[model samples]
Target: MKRNEGSFEFVVGLNRYWLKWFGLWPHCDRFSSHRLFVTLLMAISLLIPMTACLFESNDFADHIEILSKLIPIIMVTIKLFILRVKRNYLRLLVEEVARDWKNFGQLELYEKDVMMRYAKLGRLINIICIVFLFLVQLGRLDMRFEQSEEIGYSAYQALWYDLSPGTARFFIILILRSRKPFNITAGKFYIMSMSSFMNILKTSGAYLSVLKAIK
Candidate 1:
């Protein structure tokens, strides 16, 4: 079967396509200095809401709401730093893998089977992560709309600033939604590394068992 590398047409073409258009998908292949700059700018811009939530809100719930939104931006910033520092290593790994694809036949049957299983598991995990991200986004939107409804009334008017047409709240929600912590490349890297580490442990255990049996 053919693979659709760049196609992000999941869930009625809403979540994936939107994320790709906003430069959020294919996190590894899309990294560049300009994209990094834009990401940093947006992340720094989040400080406005962060500060507002910290000093302006006296309620604990408000603090939680704001922090939830800021968490993704914070994560993205951290991921960017990691990617920048490891760019050379990552590039080399990618090149090596591409060049070595023709050598798959050299692997033993068991090793090939393990690799095939890991490949399927990785794809499944990625799909689950994407779906979870979409759901989280929808939940965020629902919470924002609920907050907007509360702010529209006279009782909860004092909780939020009366900025004319209420563009401040809208902008804050927009930033929160747009800056999600769902980088596929980073996530896949983490999952694959963890899986490889576990596999190594399992192999070591099997070897020790065989030695004990021989003894």
Candidate 2:
């Protein structure tokens, strides 16, 4: 953990409460109450919807058709498990974010405004997840990172050609980095993007329909 890991709290404060509750904060733990809460949460989510099955009439052939409730829990579990296994990497990512926030004053005015806009968008997405499920927020972050392409174009339009060679070189470097596109991934396997999310939604829906038809 970096010395300034705790510092983002001043800048971010209450916005991090949800992250800490989910155990997505950078700090590690030997015994996490958050994990216990998550386990209990998952268990409850898996069980509560099943109560609907209890009301089903015995006359129906698929009388125990609890698949509807089960599907969301299963998807959520897979997503959470992936996150749990990759917690170390996620911690590093979080630390880097805190470090960046620590250096926030170092950025140019326009740069800071651009970053704050993205941060607000990310915050909005996270709020939506709390109101629903966690999937949508991940997609929105991926989509927002793709906006680096705009940064590159904006840099090009900054009249860098009229500047001294040394300053122009810095703009060139910025453009080069922006061209690479920042992204988050699920380990090395999946590029977390809006298109990937769309595919996941399609697959989930198709599977749900198929399961319903089988009943």
Candidate 3:
């Protein structure tokens, strides 16, 4: 019994030592930030079902289905945001260290930089998951719009009439997901796509200018 008590005391002491030195207390102030994220994620999840129920018509069923998918998406978005925040914090920490102790050499800086990069990668993964889900929702919207117009209705109608709040929620989910790079290749591709689009616009503008000058 005495030996067991001693072991328990040793464990408790070890925990105290680590908590004090590592600043790893369970109820620490830093946990408040994590808690806020959890709250927001839960709120988004709750909103999914509540918002879906509001759409009573069959036309809005697809919207609700897409909105339902957004619960997982918003949760993933919060995770991505948290990782981005961590990366930014690490960056700020490195900057602050550089300002305070110019002697804080590359080793310490590199360590933080590596951590920031890894956090960013995690954020990117979450973003990819979100984007994949968003694209799926978009495909659904496109199909819905196409079906509406195919049966003899207007095309490219006002979003107010064509898209419901549920659909809006799905679009928001897509935006959240697309806010990061899913992988190195995907990131590169996204950058290339943006560059290509810009180049196309520039060429188009130049062509228009030449035509105007000729006229």
Candidate No. with top TM-score: 1
Query: Compared with the true structure, what per-residue lDDT tens digits does model 2 show for residues 86-154?
Result: 778977877788778777777798977876787777767767766455566665676578686688999
Q: In model 1, what lDDT does residue 5 have? A: 21
Off by over 4 Å in 1: 1-31, 149-215
lDDT-wise, the better of 2 and 3 is 2
Predictions ranked by lDDT, top down? 2, 1, 3
TM-scores for candidates 1 onward, in order: 0.53, 0.44, 0.26
Q: Sorted by TM-score, highest first, which candidate order results?
A: 1, 2, 3
Q: Clash totals for all models, in order?
A: 0, 0, 0
lDDT for position 93 in model 2? 78
**What is the C-alpha lDDT profile of model 1 across 1-215, one tens digit per residue?**
01222221221134335334434433334445566677678888986669776788899998887887778778877876676677677557645544344344666878756755665665677778877876675555555545645543433334345665575677566545545533223355542233444676799999999999999
| Root-mean-square deviation (CA) per prediction | 15.7, 27.1, 18.0
Pairs in clash, predicted candidate 1: none
